[model samples]
Target chain A: MARTADVDDLVARARKGEPRAVARLITLIENASPQLREVMAALNPLAGRARVIGLTGAPGVGKSTSTNALVRAFRRQDLRVGVLAVDPSSPFTGGALLGDRVRMQDHASDAGVFIRSMASRGHLGGLAWAAPQAIRVLDAAGCDVVLVETVGVGQAEVEIASLADSTIVLVSPGMGDSIQAAKAGILEIADVFVVNKADRDGAQQTVRDLRNMIALAAPEGWKPPIVPTVAVKDEGVADVVQKLDEHLAWMEDSGELNRRRRARARDEIEAIAVTALRERMGDLHGHQRLDVLAEKVLDGSCDPYAAADELVEGLTESG
Target chain B: MARTADVDDLVARARKGEPRAVARLITLIENASPQLREVMAALNPLAGRARVIGLTGAPGVGKSTSTNALVRAFRRQDLRVGVLAVDPSSPFTGGALLGDRVRMQDHASDAGVFIRSMASRGHLGGLAWAAPQAIRVLDAAGCDVVLVETVGVGQAEVEIASLADSTIVLVSPGMGDSIQAAKAGILEIADVFVVNKADRDGAQQTVRDLRNMIALAAPEGWKPPIVPTVAVKDEGVADVVQKLDEHLAWMEDSGELNRRRRARARDEIEAIAVTALRERMGDLHGHQRLDVLAEKVLDGSCDPYAAADELVEGLTESG
Candidate 1:
């Protein structure tokens, strides 16, 4: 049987760079185990040490192709790379889960690259189960670069872009919806913008329109660069990578890096707290007579606010 | 000065179908006064009587245009229409907020049509501070049909969509991305889908791809129909309305309407409880010498989770 390690052992093994252990750890966290946040807290100090790059856009912006190409680019520098492509399970085919394995064929034998596809079941706002834990695993695996390829966002994808050290929003020519992106959170979230499919005729116009839109939307001094690429051919991958370096440098110089990282940490903490509270609601209720109180509040018998007030009041009064 | 009415008067005025009173009541609830939820409770029975339709998509998909066209179609039947447009500001705005206001000038003088733009002000999931109250106001305002126009959703928008009787996801014809909607929650949240700008050449392909995708993605029994339209010309608006009617019939025919509505109401009650708990966080901490507890938690001398437990435990132990 595959090793079924304890949570602490899993964390230790993951920290020591065991991919299997890391995967299990991610599953445990994503499933909201009773001890998940405690495990996360144990791993907290070790997190945020890795560079996370988020790739997102409407579907068909060549996000997966771009991710594959970027993996090659990073490997060319002899850097260990980790790829995470989130594929949602189809509702039909009796809950057919789209495994990313078929899409990332080349990386299977390459020990230097670890590619995992996640399912965003119950995923909201780009927040998927196990995502944070998965990110941590990659970080612990000592991967210098982690490329997160999302399930492509409709409007909710903003959540994915916000978590990355640098976010590249992919677009293409002839889509004719390039202008619409400026109005979406796409412009606000991108550290670098990529207009893929540079071979298309209207690509230049799309780039121009984007630059103009960014100019209008960008606060007077902050302008994110727009680059064109044919992701399938890996054309302009180097340029895209270089632009990312520039964006990171700019964020650091502008003191935005720490600010953003701190904000992300806070969001993580809050998300965990909220999730934790909900998870422990049953446990918490057992320690008190909450069910008794809640019933009274529900049937037009008493004020809910006052009942809630009594819960706290009773504690202070009796504790 | 605006007339300041109590919650009861406001509810009564709104129930009698006065737009001004409805707007005022919404303003009150959003402001988060002492009696907001109580007022919402009072108004709850009046809601769900109207057909609540939710419209969402990427920004600038002409969602508002489609909404307007649909609203006009409903109004032609002499049905009173109420629209809740979720704006970026809770009650104030500048720049694009102004642009948003400008685009919505057609019904500026219509009495039968009541329009209110709610600003969420970064409250994720796109809910206005006083949305439930606003919803009640619109419900009490005697609108036969109420359309909820989202600013854009990340996660909360998806959650909000569940509250609607019908949800139409609008998309443009020439999206660079292949997936009509990201395989995110939105893929499943939509009831009826529309690919706007049918005049565009790729519109048919977009619709076809969407139909094929939905056919593959939708669960066994609930396949949403995809409609193509030039919303600006009002082309296919009536068909869209007819499809919406058909969807309602399907829901009732399938025996899912009452179940879904009950579930949504239960969700509302649960959400209210959660929001109430958060709102009362300060109240729970009132004059309790919490700064020391907070300092200790921040300083890492005391665990944050432990501190919260201490508070909750202390509250109940006294009882």
Candidate 2:
């Protein structure tokens, strides 16, 4: 009950846009603290206001620079923004992405911006589940727009992109990035495509390739636009922001926003339920029981499915 | 009982090195068929004999060529080899990697060799869980060795590599691939490093970079050897195979093989159990219940964790 009061206080501070309170709330999420449920319950009513946008691409695609430009653009309109730079590769390197975070120092002293780098450690479902909670923190903290940037084209990146209201897939010219993006099946998730470093020699070809691909795989609604930019120089960024606004308007008008949000909430609730079930099973049976089952499966006394069935039965009974 | 007899007959045929039966069993795995448990139970006794080797790299790093070269090298010694070319990118393009799979036309006629390309669709745990069961099928089919080649540096690739007895990370010269690999945090999982395209420019630098990174990390026990190979020409392919054999020896002598296998089995069992629990919950509640709960969460009537708790209670009571 004391902790409940503290969580309420924290939520109040965060809702008033106190940077420390927001940071502390996210830390609770990252650590998966026991106070998390209390924190989420407190923050829930204040969220659902921030528009979430996701950016993803390969490592050297100027994602950080692009993110910085977007942050500046959003701030120019006096919009409060939050950035979550999620690195799926660096499990051991907590805060190892300080260099990238340093690249975002333009917003360090600005009260309107909150930039945090997160390492996707081996949590329950990795970034898929943790990210939405972090986004919720930013939303509850009164960020008008929250930007999520994920490195590389891993499944986690895809999942995070799906969670966003608009996902911008960044590609640099001359790297065959469009083809790589296509091969990685990232093209489908792109609500907006940005060809950064557009002044490069192969920029036309990159745009052409993307245009052709977009034409071929055009979905029923919301044909993703390709915007070329030199993000490092802060060129064409306002156009990206405009496109984002247009996409958000379209999403809201077409009822896609509500569907997407509901889908996201459904996934969030399911991930939590599954994680809780797993933890409960782990607490009840421990590794010793699973180890025995695994040994039996290995020795041909049982199949994995059969072992799993027995374990689930035990979990249900215990519950 | 009749289905069990059929599963036993199929397993017997697979054990006799019948390619059709092996393909059938793997098809069951790909589809997650109901007969999978019976097949796995029948196959488990015959597995644990074959060495499962994992090769991973960026797309143009010549992984398929390297796999082909290794298959040739292994077949020269009359060793039965099974290759699972897993393409995580081509989930919608089922069997769309026919071109790459066709490149192994050299071994297509050889009954001693079994090659299959797998697409890691949206399975419960994706490739991490499906791959092991597929490998078990190959292992039970009297294969002396299994080679799993995964594309890109995604988390799934890293996970699949960890499941191998010896994981070979291939990088080409002049691509900054070593740096990319290091950034992907895959350097720690390498049991053997193959510098493919060794004759290309900057080959020495790539090798040097990997050496330095390895030296810096310096994992204890079984230092991974860097092997240079021009796999397309089959030059140094035999050396790579030799290094693999040596790594296998080290793993066995160090008891690392058993440890890795047990760990893999444990993960497999846990994935299955979690999937089973999720399915049971889904069956009991259906999407309507989840949608209603999600609506409640979205409307601020409830938070995700609280909704999850209620769902779990429902699952437990229903069970």
Candidate 3:
């Protein structure tokens, strides 16, 4: 009862906009704590309130700088903001992520702004799998807008798009050409494209390239808008915000918002189920059955698929 | 019986170093055909013969060029070689990968050389999950050496390591500091470090920085050798090959090879089992049970954990 009361208390404080409680809850999620089930149960009803906007780009594309500028801009409008800086490349939550946390000290004193850096290093399914849960904690904690800032390298950009209501893909001049961006797979996921560091050389060309690619791709619904911004100077961020609002409105009117959220919920549920099963499977491995099968596989006595069948059957029978 | 004979004929041809048969078997793997179970069972006995070498680095770090040079080196000794250019970032098998294949035309005419490109875009567990089986195909087909070249951005580098007997982490001058490499989680995984593009500026600094980081990391067992190379020019490639052989010899002498192989087998079996369960889980979702549970969670009537529990229960009962 005391532990249950503690989870209830934590959720209550988080709902009241206490940053420490919000931080504690996210830490719980990050650590994959035993009490997570109770905490999620307590917080689930209070979630689904915040608008999640994901900002993603390759490293050195000014993702964090852009996020910092966007946070300041949102604070100007008096909106409560939560920033989840997810680094999928790092296996642990330290080093460079801590540096980002330090750089974000500009918002440290603002009670309306909560910033957290998560590293996906040791996580089973990586940070993308755990990020939806972190987002829920931030959402339940009364943030009006949650900015999920992730390094949009390769698969991570796609995963972030799935988590956010509106995804902003940042590209810098000299990073690569439009074909390179296409190869990186960022072209398909951008709801809003920010040509960050617009003051740099070839910024205009970057914008042109994006426009040409957008025309070529010609997505079925809700064509993505490109916004140019020198984020450090705070130039054109308001337009970025305005475009986000427009995208959100379009999504709402077009029923895309509802559909996206439904898909998110479905993914979240499946990820949770798979994780639970994976943990169970880990236990099965500990029982030496997997090792026995692995030995057989190594010796070529059985194929992996056949060995897998035996393991799955054993799991089902045990269950 | 004809289908079985067809599979038998294919395996027999592949065992005789027939390129088309090897290519067909890999195609079957990439497509995840139903006959894979039979193919794997047949291949399993013939695998565990090749020395698997994984080469990974950030894009533009000359992973493919290095792989190409190394393949040429391996072929000089009259060793049958298999090259798997795995693009975890790309979802499809064409475009850039095909371009790489074209660049590797030097090996196209060689009957002893088999080269294939795999994109992890639509793969269930990504290419890393599928790569082991593909490696087995090459291994069974009688490759004395199998080189896996993957872009080492984030988690893909780690996944490639699990599938490799010797993992070579490539870095280029001006790519970043050793700290950046460390942040990328490459420091811990490198068995041999290749300072690629050694003709470029800051090449020595890159090597020095890596030395510093490796000194600080101070990994137990084998110390990774840093080889400087301009892979395009085929410079220092022989040293890389020598290092690979040394690492392989060290592994065998120290029993690390057996341990690594056993671990690989364990991971492969678990991945297969997980994939099978995940596919079944997909089937469960099609029954509207997951959608219904997702809806309940969306409406705040239930949390994901409870819904996952219920789904797991249902799955077990149905099984």
Candidate 4:
């Protein structure tokens, strides 16, 4: 089959500030495909230009409201903002929820704002195969800040942290998961904590719980600030954004951003490597090499490691 | 440095039914090792022989206690059993603790029962890595059953379910994580559900809740029995054992045992093929290749998937 067109044209259009083209590029590769290869190739150059932040929590924790408010907040400052909300865990809808686009309509007319929902059907890891491409597309579009809001923690969304420069864990007051901030399985990955929906009754206690947990768990001198906000009212959101800037500033000041980005680069490399290796298991099968070696190892004719090493050497040398 | 003879000897001794040998083998590979290649080779033939089962939940959810009791239950029926208790999530003693042998002393003296604690240091998937080898040792040692216990939703433990013939998800009442059982990302993987510490309040409620949820969610026919058990007091351990035996029997009678085992063999083959690729990666200036690729992809000079596909094709074709 002929290779699909690279995302370069869409990127070119998007970079010209065409919102529809940008959204189309993201939509085209929102899942895994042969075309994702071309898109990712085109997208990589555009990354590292935007400050990418990730927001993640349980469903109905007001992540959409929080994300919408944040997008609006960034727009007020005349920044080109991109909002990519992840809804992968809701098994039925994939990750591209039409309702998400509806909620995002508040920013529809703003040429500075772009929103996309990444689907997780065949690719459960957020965008699965397409996420890195979408992020690249947005970056090329000159979005100064890109915010990714994952509706919940799943194998895919959690891995998103490895790619994010900064991660904000969204929690609510009455959710009974306050102390869970420490043991939320992904707490160790958070850079900032947002106590969304603080209008609820347990807001203060939730803040206290978060404070105590963060105080107890964070490495000495690496305290992550807990910002309380009623996102629906747009109250305290600017403060939340202010804290986000402070945290990013601290990451830069401490030389952590470069280190974290280096690690993120390494992780993406490994993930890609593993994926590629899985796709190429047949070369070892030709010449009846592995089958013979496997039989030998299975029967103790040769030591397993020696036989394995010999097989690799044989395949490589023969190659 | 020469590869350790200790790993090879310990694995052999463990396969020969030596408890101390099994314990030592578990401890040696529990940490990151350049020797994982040699050890895994030594372990390959011996793997895929035992019936591996995984149990997971929140901390203090009594996984160890339940595992200990389950082993005793198997012993009661004269079934030779091997228990691989995974304690690697956190350092019970700073990232390495192989103390389950001492804690499960009752079955320690019985040659038919081999218990080992796994401590994973750096390998993200080491839980599955160590497990298949350990289970192999037990299987070749003439063991009829092997149980692996882990906590929370982790990638390492999740791999166990794929390797195991049947998987059990262990949960307790008070933690209120039965909802976790419903949302327990691994619920789909469980063949049996055990509500441990059933003597506690809300045991019935936990069972009722799990059953209702299962009835709603389980496929048309399969409804995993949520066996209520006091694993500590041996209260419902017999029923669990009975259920396990019935499940195994059903599998054998229904031709599922052979079919599943054959599927596992294919997985074993695929896993070994991937491992072979990784070993080859170790030999190349892999770091150099990745760096070059990163630079190319960053500037959009090359696509990542194509680069990745090229990497794999180069290794296998040129190896």
Candidate 5:
């Protein structure tokens, strides 16, 4: 746990774009230290300034390569960038694979870039609870744009959408990658689609498949555009960046950006309250009141709903 | 919303092994009907009688095929079986794919087998909230065994483990399937591992990799055994069943089964309570209380934690 004074100093330094301070603040959030409330209090005013772009795709889709390319592109425009690559695989293992670190080292020498890998870590609310705070840290540290890259598997992609202002869903040609993306419900969360490995055969077909699916199922306001890119060779990378900028512009023009940030803030508040309540409930566990109620439900004297009602009542009355 | 009398009739019929009644009860749970309390009340006494086996693996690992084989194996013992194949893909579309339905038709004519596919549906609590109730319905409907099959992607697999007495994680040889499983944190939840497509090349290698990983892991008191099976050929499946039975026996003898069920009940009760709170909060949204608090947080007048404290206080005071 960090002391309040030290945390305040770290926040001040992070505001000045000190990498060590920024990393320390994120570590504090991840550990759920006693000083978290103070840190968030200090950092709250500095947040909501950076554009959060979420990049996601299935394994073997070159998401890391594309992320590196995007960082280089953003740097070329003289914009500071932050990357939060969430490793869904490293939760239980406690260590990330070597591949991502090696791929991201291209920007290691640049002071304008900050890269962090977040493991799922089995937190109470999962990554959804933690990523927002991390994004806030980067946003406060003066990154013009933050890229949250995650493996496009199941719930993670959806959670990423909630945290990102713009989401890019990447797919490569062949091996049923596009179909897998569709099945994973990637179509709903993607604001921009990228078909990487454009040198491969069927890249056009992959793009066509995405376009057709988008046309068939897209919502009323926006249509996701598919961009072809060979991320390794940096071909068509500029177009991807241009599309992202346009999407963000559209969001701002339509007032969707404010709505999204408000929703994000709302979710964060709710998650905090729920976590606090759960902690209260945990403190009540093994006590006489909850034990008796649980026993009743177990013995069929009451249904779980009724038991839950009683528990909630107990919490309120005790409060 | 269903009427109380109708819900009671459905519960009564479900207990008598009427398939339509069972299906109707499950539908009510899925839809979260107003009469759900009554149905759960009536079914509470009849639950805790079925063994829940969670089967999961990545796509193309032949999860459905293996589930079908397990259903057949259980039927040969003259035991009634219920299957809930959770379709993560079908939630947004509001319709389940025909693949699972077509595969499970082998037991369509058998009176003792019941299979239902559950779409993810983008529900408030996702599968974690709905699966327990569906399992209860099956338990009350007189299933000696229930199988919950889900795509072993990301968080869904972990959620399934919480609802089952035992979990079997299936993997096919090659395609880096085993590595993907490891990355997804499947090792923590797996009580038994089945290497499907045992006749394929690298079947032994997949088995070896799983064994090495399990050996390195192997949480205290139990070692997860790896079984190789060719589900299409119905080879080595009986051994899989035998392993499942052995695991259940071990859990019972060590009193782990009771502990797991108690934990499940606790989670179910907590989920219901939290959901109730969330619904109440949702109702308060756009109203002066929550909206004002949100504004304060957004404008940096207050931190999120403090706002959360106030919101929870308002909820308690109103209650």
Candidate 6:
């Protein structure tokens, strides 16, 4: 647990854009420190201003290169940027890949840019559970834009859409990337589509396939546009940024931004409440009540549904 | 909602191995019916007897064919087998892939075998959340063996491991299947590894790789055996079953089966309780308490953590 004065000093430094302060806050959140409630309390006044953007694609896609290009573009616009890269790989295998970090070396010395990598750690909800709190930390630290990059697989991509104001789903030529994207359900969450490695053969065909798929679906309030970019060479990077800007403007004008923020807040609250309840239940691990209920279920005296209801009622009454 | 008498009648018929009664009970669970508690109560005594087996592999890894083979083998042993195929694909895309159901047509006329496909329908925990109750239904319906098959992708595979007494991870040659399996964390959950396309060029190599990977891992209580099979021709299918039986024997002898069941029961109880709390919170929508707390966090008057605490306190008190 951190002391009250210590938390206050860290929050103040974080608000001043001290990189070390920002990093410490995130580490505390990751470790689930006892003083997290206090840290968030201190920083809440300065949060909720940064524009969060999410980038997702398959493992071999040029997500890192495109993210680097996007960072450079945002920096050129004189906006401070924060990057959170979430790796969905197993924790036993270790953290985010080294190549993803090395590719962003160009922004390493830029004081206006901050980059952090997060591993799944075998968490139940993949990146969704931890990324939102980190976003709050960066948002309070005064980053004008935050880029959340995740591998577009499983629940990680779905969670990214909920956390970000804009989501960009990237695909490259070949590798069944388009079909994988559709099967993973990224097509529904993508606010902007970026066909990376545009110089590769069949890039145009991939773009056409995506366009055809999007056309088949009934129109939503906004149509996602496909932008092609050779991220390695930074070709057409500006076009991707332009589309992002357009999407953000539309979100603002349509009041979708407020709605999204409200939903995000609600999700965060629900996650926290559920986590709290789980902790409380876990505390009763060896206690007689839960054990008795479980025994009843095992012995056929009661069903799991009935046992669960009784447990919930017990916890609420005891609390 | 269903009448108490109707639910009791359905449970009685299902316990007698009536397919329609079993299907109706599963449908009620899927729809989260009001009578679920009563139905579970009636069925609890008949469960905890069946041997649950989980089979998972990539989308094109011959899971359906292998599952079909395994069901045939079980039937030859005079065992009643129930198959639950879970599809993680989108529901609007349609129900379970017709090809999967078609491939299992060999068992369509078998009175001792039941095959059912479950589409994900955008559940929060993928197939895991619903599959457990469905397994209970099958177990109570007098099945000697229940085979749970799922595409070895996403969180569904992970959850399947927790539900089944034994988990078999399947792989075939080419298509980067081995690498995908490693990346998906199935390597850790596999109680038995099956190389399904044994005639392929790299089948032996795949087995060797899995064996080497298992050897590298610090030995747990059990060492998973690698079995080779060509499911389409029913070649080596008996070897797979032999390994499954050995694993089951080991689990029973070591008392691991009971421990796993207890943990599964705990997980179910927690999931249900959390879901109940979420519904309560959702019902609070448009209520002043939640809205006020969210507003406080959004306006920086309160942090999300504090707001969550307040919300939980309010909900518990009101309830």
Index of the highest-lDDT prediction: 3
Model 5 chain B poorest 10 in a row by lDDT: B88-97
Each prediction's fraction of true contacts recovered: 0.03, 0.67, 0.76, 0.22, 0.48, 0.58
> What TM-score would each prediction reach against the true structure?
0.75, 0.94, 0.97, 0.76, 0.96, 0.92
Residue-wise lDDT of candidate 6 within A1-319, one digit each (tens)? 6689999999999999898899888777666677888888887888989999999887678888899999999999999999988755555323344543575578877889988776655654345556788898898898999999986665667778989999999988984855556667878889999999989999999999999889987558989999999999999999999999999999999999988887888778777877887777766645666667766777778888888888888778778
DockQ, structure candidate 3: 0.76
Summarize candidate 4's per-residue lDDT along A94-194 as a digit string, tens digits.
Answer: 32556656866797678888887765433422343445566767887889998987655434346567667788888888776643343244557677888
Candidate 2's residue-wise lDDT over A196-280, tens digit each?
9999889889999999999888778899999999999999999999999999999999999999999899889888998887787
B77-167 per-residue lDDT for model 3 (tens digits): 9999999888776766667456656865887678888888877766776765689999999999999999988867887888888889999
- Residue-wise C-alpha lDDT for candidate 4, range B25-85, written one tens digit per residue: 5555555456656666666666555666667665567877888888888888898888766
Tell me the number of clashing residue pairs for each predicted model. 15, 0, 3, 4, 1, 0
Give the TM-score ranking, best first.
Answer: 3, 5, 2, 6, 4, 1
Alpha carbon deviation, residue A243, candidate 2 (Å): 1.7
Q: DockQ, per-model, please? A: 0.18, 0.65, 0.76, 0.25, 0.59, 0.56
Q: lDDT scores for all predictions?
A: 0.65, 0.83, 0.85, 0.66, 0.82, 0.80
lDDT of 5: 0.82
All candidates: CA RMSD (Å): 5.9, 2.4, 1.9, 5.3, 2.0, 2.7
User: Which digits, one per residue and each the tens of the lDDT, describe model 2 over residues B1-319?
Assistant: 3388888899999999998898888878777787887888778878889899999987688998999999899999999999987766556534444654686578877999998877776676678668889899999998999999887676766787667989998888876655567767777788899999999999998889999989999889988889999998999998898898899888889998888888888778888888777776667656577788889999999999999898888888878
Return the top candidate by DockQ: 3
- Select the stronger candidate by TM-score from 2 and 5: 5
Docking quality band of candidate 5, CAPRI definitions = medium
Model 6 regions more than 4 Å off: A97-104, A121-126, A177-181, A285-288, B97-100, B124-128, B174-183, B285-288
lDDT tens digits, residue span B188-228, model 6: 88999888888989888888888877888756898998888
Q: How many backbone collisions does model 6 have?
A: 0
Ranking of all candidate structures by their DockQ, best first: 3, 2, 5, 6, 4, 1
